[model samples]
Target: MRESLRLLRDELSRINSPDELSSWKERFEELLREAVEKKLGVKCRSPVYLFKTLYHAGFINREELDALLQFDELNDPSFFERLLERLETRL
Candidate 1:
């Protein structure tokens, strides 16, 4: 997970336009889902933290964030709510 995030960060640094950033949104979402699934058993906070980091870094905008949150695989409304609350505070 840390390695994936590192790769994402490195890729983000190379983004030269809005198009490039837009292209990465799905990759970020995939990473979030994978991280969440891998850590689901342990109740790890990595997924939320990764979202926050991507958001703060401008790798994703509000719309993308919402889209990512809409993932049904999470199957946890409270977790989504908590992440939404965290995002609101950051905004």
Candidate 2:
């Protein structure tokens, strides 16, 4: 596992293009989501609670959360709750 991580780190260091980096970022996010699902026994696709938990844990960054929720509010609890309700309805 350490060897694999070392290799991955070396490869990441050599990546130069935005397109390539973006591809890698997507893959890493998918891997993290899969691990989270496996550990929590929840399908992360439609679970706002799980996503919020991850965000609070710093496992998911603000930019990633914004993309998922289409929300930009940082400290507005009421607004965030409303958005979560709206998004849940869309599911």
Candidate 3:
């Protein structure tokens, strides 16, 4: 998971156009969905860890990180919905 997130961060850092950014956002949302589904037990921490890592690494700004972290306080069932909503707004 850490490796995956790192790779994503690397790709995110290389993005130079809006199309690339949009693609990245789609991939990110997919990753979040997968984590929520397959890593049910780690859902709470995994996404937060990845997002925080990205923020600290300068891949994402403070505002984006804060919005993503908002899911931390949400119930498990609402995680995907909230994340999708945030991502849509970002796009």
What local lDDT score does residue 19 receive in model 1, on the 0 to 100 scale? 67
lDDT of all predictions: 0.54, 0.49, 0.55
lDDT tens per residue, model 1, 1-91: 6666656666666777656665665575566656554654323355566555555556457765665555434433334345434433432
RMSD of 1: 11.2
The TM-scores of all predictions, comma-separated, are 0.46, 0.45, 0.46
For candidate 3, write residues 1-91 as lDDT tens digits.
Answer: 5455556666766777767766776576567555444544333346677677656545457866777776434223233334444443332
The window of 10 residues in a row where model 2 has the poorest summed lDDT is 71-80
Q: What is the C-alpha RMSD of each candidate to the true structure, in Å?
A: 11.2, 11.9, 11.9
Model 1 residue 79 CA deviation (Å) reads 21
Stretches off by above 4 angstroms in model 2 are: 1-8, 46-51, 56-91
lDDT of 3 at 82: 46
Off by over 4 Å in 3: 41-91
Error at 44, model 3, angstroms: 13
Candidate 1, poorest ten consecutive residues by summed lDDT:
72-81
Candidate 1 vs 2: which has more TM-score: 1
